[model samples]
Target chain A: MTPLVVGTSAIKRATTPELVFAVVRDALIAHAHDRTTVPPPLHLQFPDADGDCHVKAGWVTDTPGFAVKIATGFYRNPAAGLPTNHGLVCAVSARTGEINAILDDQGLLTAWRTAAAGALATHAMARPGAATLAVFGTGEQARLQVEWLARLRPIDTVLVHGRSKDKTRSLCEAFDALGHHARPALADEAAAADMIITTTPAPTPVLQARHVRAGAHVTGIGTDMPHKNELPPALFARAALIATDDHRQCLDHGDFGHAVRAGVTTDTSDTPVGLLLERPVERPDGAITVADLTGVGALDAALAAAVLRELAS
Target chain B: MTPLVVGTSAIKRATTPELVFAVVRDALIAHAHDRTTVPPPLHLQFPDADGDCHVKAGWVTDTPGFAVKIATGFYRNPAAGLPTNHGLVCAVSARTGEINAILDDQGLLTAWRTAAAGALATHAMARPGAATLAVFGTGEQARLQVEWLARLRPIDTVLVHGRSKDKTRSLCEAFDALGHHARPALADEAAAADMIITTTPAPTPVLQARHVRAGAHVTGIGTDMPHKNELPPALFARAALIATDDHRQCLDHGDFGHAVRAGVTTDTSDTPVGLLLERPVERPDGAITVADLTGVGALDAALAAAVLRELAS
Candidate 1:
């Protein structure tokens, strides 16, 4: 039989958040053991045209093939009421170089994989029995992060912080509909939560080091570009340990880039979250942990493989 | 209005050799002028599986678009009467980052583009009114070189030289059907022709430098890998000028690579074929010229845009 060429609808029906989260966790762990080949990501930037397209690819050795994802961000599309972000994924055979399937994921797979990464980070770093969670953005990622993290930990209250009050309230309303308690909170109050996730596209730091309390597990899921940052540079110094999905990628771009540039931390010795997952480390009591995820190719490859398997079954 | 998802049939129906040649030439020119951003090429090598997939992408400023080509080579498929090479092209809007078309060309576009590239080189470096061309291979590329170059130059006689007599005879029959004179000849006899084209995947020098006469314009198109070679190292010393689609790429992984390693040439300042095309050079009679093409991404980008335009019309 020919490889399936599926659309967004098929992918949505084929995968659930829990399955994707597990797949993503395994993929990231594979990165640490050197069981996967993830090439340095590349992109075509159309600065004059107000857009950029990032291309990432990777392959995992065990029961996993390969995948190539092309994700685009058109900063001006929202002005026309069109989608600002979208892309496709191609799953290929590691044995024959045959493209086994092309999932016109339309960026759905990317979103899910990203949220899953956040969940993995939160699970590995957050304090056990922590009841309060805070999200720094009110977008889809913020909502998904809250939902995914809730499943991974025992959470009772959710605090939301955004530049706009109405948008933040809407995010809270989403949690309320899902039978969870959520409310808009001030930036300082949100930073004080036991687990905080920053998913905003802010170009400057929104979370201050002074407000972040002890034993806080903070994950920065936004700031994919060099100019975009969410966490204050000083926060890295305040955290007990800084972890990242792909340390090299984060150091070159995203929040770590700013941190490095600001001389806040010249630490290239940060740990990969994969290593932390492979060998579970009980967090030193009352220690603050920071995770920076700028998205890597392995997670996409794993998610695509999982989705293809789902459709096959 | 929806982005066209086409296969080889549509690509064939929508493009003529001349149109594609023009498109490719324009693209190369755009590359020379630095009007196109051609990212470094990437590949996936499944050594255990005896397969490799090369991925290339670029964007031309004038077209305001981007293109990505995924070309795969599966070495063992020929035993099953299956084509060992296949790939696809995607043309996209740079302004909006929207995928405008998906050309499932099945490697047809790549073959045509390669042949067109040969034509462009021949037209640029071959002596005016050159005839009696010798092609050193019996594969599809060797055959297509004859057809595409015949239109670019005044060729009436073609000398075929391959180790396999049966394959060479069949190649001769192809030219015979086109109302041209083609006959099998010795390596020396072929080298003495006015123009020589080596499209064979020979791992060692096939054309001895002593056999290549003066005033012959030679092109080695088969040796894109470091381990492959078709032209003798000493041949470079005899040529008045060495031109390539991309000088940097050729030096890294083509005939130029072997020649450089052999100490036959330390010349890194070779002119680009586009420069020669832009300013048609009047070659002095009896001057030997060489052109190396290692497949650049700009040509793929331009070809995708051209195909999309044809479909739109």
Candidate 2:
């Protein structure tokens, strides 16, 4: 069997942002429904290293793509010229453990998986025909959120807030190319959108609690590590319902961790993304909803499985 | 840029048991001197499965060859006809994570690495010029043990013990063909040899305290998982000194776990194999010595690195 080399360039060539978003969304839903088998993340700590490495290898056998994936990332000091998060996802044959495809997109899989988590959360929490959206950050993850959210809802306008004017302009241009009504906005304009998506690596809080409007849904995806934060801890106090991709991981490394550390309520019975995806739950009509998408290995396994099946067929 | 495919048949064709022994032994010595970078083992556990699957991937950079190895195995229910242990070792590029070779020798890399571990322990613990040897099991590991032990010591005679007489006789024939005195013997006769190697997957104790003589060095490589045991727990009390590949793993899953659970000792400080390899520790002249060879990911990484360097040159 010839091994398929699905590098970052190949993914860029073969898949559009919209197609990737749709596949990833379906993959997340499939995984959350227990239609996939994703092994626990394997943790590795290099000798004398400041942080740890997380490895998740799994096979999504029932997802039409009998493929196995091995994803590895390093959570270490960024001063080492290595991104604090970088890894490759290898899709393999579930029948033979033969590596079939290698996706060299260092953090692309994480971005897509995070967006899938958002879409999954929105399906459970958002009101029908919810349109206006606000995204903080003009980076890869921010771009992914726009594409993925666009697929799930009919967003007539998008407010993009970024630290850099040039990046915000480029993001606006990209969104325009996608035929969305997008414009650069001040950070406070995030209150005008029905939904807010924050994807930044800032150590300090980028979104304040006062800027969030009532009944607005917020999805935070960047604070997946202990040293990073995207949303203020105060925001959790106002959230009527808080859902997360993986409660255990979120409790340890997500925005929820910061909230819990800051003396916020630790009641997590209803926060698991799996629970929201598996069962029909009531979403209060005018209450603030927040979904912490710290990214889960299961979603990556699910999407890789889907892509492998597609490529195989 | 071509991935090397070293299947079971190919490994059997490309390497003789003798050559594999030598390669593994040299790798162990080279690795002991801090000459390799060994990655931690990667694990995968299917949902609802009783046990986990492990993958050990590594690169031996300084050896004459350039190869990366991925060895896969499982600890699962034995009724599945799956051998409970199945794996392939893929040797890939040192510069790139490209596959160079795939060897499906039923975890031959395990056999080689285990033999190397035994060889390394013998080199560090056995009395200089030790000759007579006794090896348990007539399987591939047993064959490799004999070959590796012979390289460390000039063995004029080797006593073989196994459950089946016909299988032992077949092993004896293979050994005798190599011009050594190899013969099937009763388990008690194993005590007469200066060096004893046990490589069977026996659930209960195969070697007892009374059977091992003074100054004899024992290396047990079979009992790796927590449920497995090859050496009697009482034997650990009698040994003057004990060492292991990785002390924590050994304390958790190896013969040492059994010993510790049985209240053999309160302290395990002197048990790390790295201690024995790094320093010239004092061993009582006529005291019994024991070395537990539960495998470690570091050794796989070490060997893979060496093999890769060798292939490159």
Instruction: Write the residue-wise lDDT of candidate 1 on B1-313 in tens digits.
Output: 2345787777888999989888988888877888887776666666776777778888877576788887778788787676777667778788888878778888888889899998788878887777889999998899998899877776889999999999999999999998789999999899988889999878998888878877888988887777678888788877788888877778877887777878878857477888887777778788888888888888888888888788779
Q: TM per model?
A: 0.90, 0.79
**How accurate locally is residue B262 in candidate 2, as Cα lDDT from 0 to 100?**
88
Give the alpha-carbon lDDT of every model: 0.83, 0.66
DockQ, all models? 0.47, 0.20
**What's the distance in Å from true for residue B307, model 1?**
1.9
List clash counts for every candidate, in order.
0, 20
Kindly list the per-residue Cα lDDT of model 2 for residues B1-313, writing each as its tens digit.
2234444554444554455555554444554455545454555544344444565543333432232234333334345555545545544333322344544446666777787678768767887767778888887889888887676667788899999999999999988987789999888898657888888878998777788888888888888667679888787888888887656667776787788788875446336665676556577888888888777665565444444444455
Regions more than 4 Å wrong, model 1: A1-4, A62-64, A185-189, A257-268, B1-3, B161-165, B183-193, B200-211, B223-239, B257-268
Residue pairs clashing in model 1 are: none
Leading candidate by DockQ:
1
lDDT of 1 at A290: 90
